[model samples]
Target: MRTAAELKYGEKGIINDIDGSHPSSRRILEVGFTPGQEIQLINMSAFRDPIAFSVRGTIIAIRKDEASCIKVL
Candidate 1:
């Protein structure tokens, strides 16, 4: 039940499920945050609001609140 926002720097996890209740869920999925996809916590801001992740060979940065909707295992 760990969320992407909880991942430590350099930690990796497989995407389990996405909270469709979130307004940006569809956009997140469209960009590659799909179930079964592997994601890594590559970087985070000093405040940790916008975190960067490596998924599908690309690095993407997302907000902590938005990342909370991503369930990871």
Candidate 2:
């Protein structure tokens, strides 16, 4: 498994788990980062801080710090 942050642009993976202890985990869940969900790395900022992803049919942007806590297979 690898972290969401490790996924290159246009790559896809299934969400395996998330670090629940992370403060943003709840917000990430609410935004639909649940286990088994398929997510695609859509794009990234110039500095690669906030990355854009396609999840649950919607495109959302999340920071690298938060993405690092999301494990994907």
Candidate 3:
């Protein structure tokens, strides 16, 4: 498994699991990042702070810190 943030440009994967107990995890799940959904790494800034991705057919941008808590396979 790998982190959502670890996906390179144009990489794609299913949301295998979320591996944290933080409240952010619940919020992430609520945002259509549930297990078994597909996600694609769309782009990243020069600093790679906020990474862009397609989640459940919608493009969403998340901070790298939040992406680290999302596991994909």
| Best lDDT among the predictions, by candidate number | 1
TM-score of each candidate? 0.96, 0.96, 0.88
- List the lowest-lDDT window of 10 residues for candidate 2: 1-10
Better of 1 and 2 by lDDT: 1
The local distance difference test score of each candidate is 0.96, 0.94, 0.86
Model 2's C-alpha root-mean-square deviation from the true structure amounts to 0.7
Return the lDDT, model 1, position 22.
Answer: 96
Off by over 4 Å in 3: none
| lDDT string, candidate 1, 35-68, tens digits | 9999999988899779999999999999998999
Task: Identify the runs in model 2 with alpha carbons over 4 angstroms from their true place.
Answer: none
Model 3 residue 63 distance off true place after TM-score fit, in angstroms: 0.8
- Predicted structure 3: lDDT: 0.86
Q: Judged by lDDT against the true structure, how good is candidate 2?
A: 0.94
Worst 10 residues of 3 by lDDT: 19-28
Candidate 3 residue 71 Cα shift, in angstroms, is 0.8
Superposition error at 27 for model 2 (Å): 0.2
Pitting candidate 2 against candidate 3, the one with the higher lDDT is 2
A best-first ranking of the candidates according to their lDDT comes to 1, 2, 3
